[model samples]
Target: MIYVVEDDKSIRNLIEYALSEKSYQVKTFADGLDIVDVVRENAPELIILDIMLPGKDGIEILNEIREFSDIPIILLTARTDEFDKVMGLESGADDYITKPFSVLELLSRVKAILRRSAKKDTDHINYNNISLNTKKRTVKVDGKLIDLTYKEFEMLLFLMNNIGNVITREDFLLKIWGYDYEGETRTVDVHIASLRSKLLDAGKLIKTVRNLGYKFGEI
Candidate 1:
């Protein structure tokens, strides 16, 4: 699902109509608060956030959402501040788009990211106590269900899909976080920890190499 939070009803309708033409499940909101609750309850795959929201700005929404979930966010803003864009990217936005943009260009970017992310999941993954249904965005451990945030699921799937290989922190920040963000490698480590903690006590399956990277080994 693509949740769009734009104040302008005309723009929102245009985007919704265009995306719907491609058969995508699209939801539109006039304000961040209008759909902020839905983000927690039923997280969409991607969010189109507007920076200059009425009550709560897009940056705040990104921060609030990042506190719990890591849904892929695409920031749409009128301000062309480099520092603000950097802040948005660092605050967990997967992509940033400036206002008065081309809908086709936006559509292409969204599709590309989602397609690449989807392709990354189905490549290779093997586990004894865990199972992931990539298409459904669901996970199972030891034949039981497990709950994971969007980022957690993506992080886990990325590791499992590349088991036995060492993935560097820089690579993770570039690919998963959507840029070579100016954050410490420890952020990746923290995400790995968060992903590992949810799996059924098999956190050690994700191996850490000192001064190197991470490797996922089947348990």
Candidate 2:
């Protein structure tokens, strides 16, 4: 189950149509106030939250939900300020997308985040032909060892841990780089590109979303 909160009728309907086409059960709300009770009564597996909403804003609703549940949430906003992105993530959003984003991207992010949230942690994670040994801090493709840099190893580990999640550049900076690491998000892109190249045949598993960050598993 998924809940989409957006005041824009066309966008809301479009989102609903996209998710429905993918065989997901969806509920749409035009106002933040209109969905609070429903969220409390029937907790959805995931939420597509729009920042600008009538009555109560998405941030306010997010705060309210955080007080009760830690369900995965993906924010939608028109703001491109880094401060706003950081604030949204700090406020408990698992992911976010800027406005005028591709419906394909949104749907991809939705599926990826849900897959990530549903995953259980284990010392060994194997997907396709790639294997990640968290306990040993090693990665192998087809039983052959693959050497990675300190940062690359950590990055791959993080991605493997989250699996199909859509991790924004902000998320990479906050998780891999220290939250206060005073560097541009481009550093993440560089590292990701390097990691992908090193991963060889398995590199294709790391997908890049235009204007967004990357998802670390097959969609």
Candidate 3:
């Protein structure tokens, strides 16, 4: 099932109708007030969220959802500012669509995100006492479970998978956030910093490459 949270009744109905026409089960919400609790109870396959809401904004709701689940979220916004887009992407939104968007485009994005999420990697990666089980989507450092946000996990997995090689911020955006993403490269830095912090001492393995990017390996 899919969930759409939009304050505008017209837009909400439009989205609901469009998604339903595609044979997708959809639930609609007027605001983000009860989304977290509803998601906690029964997470949907994906969420279409409007950035400007009555109660909690989409970014706040995105952060709260990321705290527990990584359910794919596509943000909807009337604003065309870069700040809102960057903030949404940095806060864990899978994608975002500006207002006055085509329903066809929205459906396409929804389909693409759902398709990507369905694809899974079954490999297990271990490096420098950090254990990652891709199939299980779990990470352990020094034999203890470590909590990682969805982006953090993906960033770590990408780094570990390319040990001894330097990975640029642009590479990260293209690889983890998708090639079409237009957010600032600084988003990569923020996630890396948070990831390193959560990994504790093992964080040292992720070394900065001076003028280039980052490298994950023994220094």
Q: Which candidate leads in TM-score? A: 3
Candidate closer to the true structure by TM-score (higher is better), 1 or 2: 1
Error of 1 at 138 (Å): 14
Using Cα atoms with residue i matched to residue i, what is each candidate's TM-score against the true structure?
Answer: 0.56, 0.54, 0.58
lDDT of 1 by residue, 51-101 (tens): 999999999998887765555788988898899899999998988989788
Q: What ranking of all candidate models by lDDT puts the best one first?
A: 3, 2, 1
Worst 10 residues of 3 by lDDT: 120-129
Pitting candidate 1 against candidate 3, the one with the higher TM-score is 3
181, model 3: CA deviation in Å? Answer: 52
Looking at model 2, report the run of 10 residues with the lowest lDDT sum: 120-129
Instruction: Give the TM-score comparing model 3 with the true structure, all chains together.
Output: 0.58
Model 3: per-residue lDDT, tens digit, 144-219? 7899989999999999999999999989998998885787788888999999999999898899988778999885
Which pairs, if any, clash in model 1?
A: none
- So what's the TM-score on candidate 1? 0.56
Q: Over all chains combined, what TM-score does candidate 2 have?
A: 0.54
**Each prediction's number of clashing residue pairs:** 0, 0, 0
